[model samples]
Target: MKKNSESKAGTSRRDFIKAGTAAAAGFMVVPRHVLGGAGFVAPSDKLVIAGIGVGGKGESDLKSFHDSGKAEIAYLCDVDDRRAAGSVQRFPKAKYYKDFREMLDKEHKHIDAVSVSGPDHNHAIHALPAMQLGKHVYVQKPLTHDVYEARVLTEAAKKYKVVTQMGNQGASGDGVRIMREWFDAGLIGDVHTIYTWTDRPVWPQGIQWPAQKAEVPKELDWDLWLGTAPYKDYVDKLVPFNWRGWWDYGTGALGDMGCHIMEAPFSILGLQYVKDVQASVGTVYVDEFKRGYFPESCPPSSYAVLTFPKTDKTPGDVKIHWMDGGIQPERPEELGPNEVFGDGGNGILFVGTKGKMMAGCYAENPRLLPTSLTEQHKLPVKYERVPGGASGHYAQWVEACIAGHGKKEVSSPFSIAGPLTEALLMANLAIRGSDLRIDNRYPGRNLKLIWDNQNMKVVNFDEVNQFVKREYRQGWELPTV
Candidate 1:
């Protein structure tokens, strides 16, 4: 069976002709059985999927969908051939292309859905058209590069009536459900304050762009990779992963892991568009006398505070603190001196009127403070468990697509992922606002920028609104929903 599957994996769409010829030679295959009628596909029929950005995390995403056994990898697209090599080898029969536009243009008929696992900047660029063409989309986390794009995609999902899921797999994990149960049971009363921190940037940041430019790799399409970001001379090591630290291509640490770290609280608390946001970021010194301020690059470390209006789950407004670049909140008194705080490196903490709770990245390993409370408390399960938990996220989206739009429930559909993404980007506005300088003076400092979620703009800070919706490059435009 493994050999048979391998052989099938290597067959391209062009092989259909050969398959037809073979079938005509008295070797017809069994027809799929439909329970209701002949028009309906049998349970065995798989959804044909096209993967955009089939490298790194994208490569793993394609594998997960294929492994679901309910989806067939029909096409793979990527700008970097070297990065996409593994996926191309694994899905031998899948057609390959460098530009996602070309792939979607030619293979739209053959693709049932599109899985987008690209850099933060190009997610919306790749996803918008696919959705317009009525293809279901599963975009990797941070859904879009900016707040406006997130809102557009969210509305587009509903307008197109396509099954949509953001690649924040933790949204479907048991850890969040367990935490939800605890919160609903009033173990941790109304959550008034929340803190999520990460030791990210693990990449270069708080530095100037390299003065020297390097030759583009032979196998990589540098122009195509830039997609919606402004074009610049090729820099060393920016192709595969280092792009995360740059403002043009990435969303810094908060956007990198915010979805994973803050997902549980957003869901359990029913949080939405933030009411207001403010921030302060650490600075790097280029020399003994001069401080480094690279607007193109994210700051080395920063702290942001977002205020969310009250929801039924909370008594009043919720103040959420986000720290990155190795910053963390203070440890709770309930925890032992040596006890781990949110898995020791990155985690989320919730402080309520009654007690405190914390969880590591992806809301995993959730526990109430005092350690003993986790094991001692018993709460009735009120949420449905996602099949296969976090790992099930891919299969869930695949099945949802197979079931058609609105037919099945998806764990991190655009509706939910969009607001979460928008809120994060809103927090980012504060970070970027605080960084703005006017003749060596930071004017955006110490101001609580009011937000008009409906208009998607910062009422108090007009300059920061530029980051709300970035202008796309000449060739790419965010599709009008």
Candidate 2:
């Protein structure tokens, strides 16, 4: 393998860096801070962005980029035309393609950055190539389908020297910053416990894959949609939305909301990879007569407790409890009977030695327990707040990419996002371990899934290690980087 810095061959990483350095001239002419409006940018300063998976959250991500005014949607790619229609109409001038390879091969020179909003299983494959080509990348939450992929992405960002961000907008929210301030000021003493809950899996989970396969939609490329996952027959209501429940495509509820909820604790407490995990999933019944355990799909509800190694901010190991599928911890007595818990269906709470603090999903509306303390303890903010908070996340990346890697800070760069994602995926290992059945028993349920971060595997329950890295389908593979 050639050294990353040596530019011996054509388009070496070094060459790419030089090209990017030269491109930085477009942004240096006038700084974004001096630019007056949110959607106003000189033509010379625009960052050409290519979007992969242009539908639903993907569509909205592209819209936010364009709204920043610094990003011009130069190219669009998605496996399904039906999903890409809205974005295609919105950015009529952008060249369109059904495959990301074609778009990157033909338009790499034009695209300064890439925004990836494909399914969880497809994130790594979609983002890696763009980064290898030296394009800044913004990937959707959870970062990848598995822990190994997350680690690969984390290292790739450093090796390739690309500006990278995860699509967890809440990471840029003021509430998280304020939480960090309170924690730093010792308002909340050594955080020992945390609780994050969400009501998700609204589609389907804890069940078996549909036995009846449906005809593949005409506008969708079924093969491409499978991307890195193993091939499976198409099923009704699986395209676009309900894929979250299936392990083949999505990371289940944790993938859907873990980034939004667990992020607060991870950032504020300086949490790293999980040390071990224990989990119990809600049971399903078949015809109300027998208990059912479906290994192929995520459970309808799960409660996982992950232990993280001690950090600079913690007195000892941090215990984080994650509840999903409407299951939540007992309400804290400090909260009034009328006061809402976790924005009704979702929330994050920190239990510290001095007091307790809580916030809703996205870490929005954070407050100290006893309610009175929130108003009583106002600490000076040390960390600068992200402009526009969550809404500013898009512009933050756009500006950072223009400023070049190492020049600016992103809210959820892969460095942070990778560990955060691994923590959640580790929890997933426990969840998946609990469901594995032998002849007639589920032995994995009794195991405490110990994590070996160095090797990226579970030391106690070896079977669960399968989830850490998954095999991609033929003709598609993870980027060498």
lDDT of the structure predicted as candidate 2: 0.85
RMSD of 1: 7.8
Error of 2 at 115 (Å): 0.4
For model 2, the superposed segments whose C-alpha errors exceed 4 Å read 1-43
Give the range where candidate 2 is weakest over 10 consecutive residues by summed lDDT.
1-10
Q: Candidate 1 lDDT, tens digit per residue, 158-231? A: 87788999999999999999988998888888799999999997998888998899999999888888888898
User: On residues 1-481, what C-alpha lDDT tens digit does candidate 2 reach at each position?
Assistant: 0011211112333333333323211111122223334553435577788999999999999999999987888899999999999999999999999877667655665567899998899998888867776678999997999999999999988887888999999999999999999998888788999999999979899888889999998999998788778888889999889989999888899989999999999999899989899999998999779898688999999999999989988879999999999999999999999999879999999999988899999999999998878998877889999999999999999989888778889999999999999999999989989998889889898678888889888988787888888877765666456
User: How high is each candidate's TM-score?
Assistant: 0.91, 0.91
With a 3 Å backbone cut-off (N, CA, C), the pairs that clash in candidate 1 are none
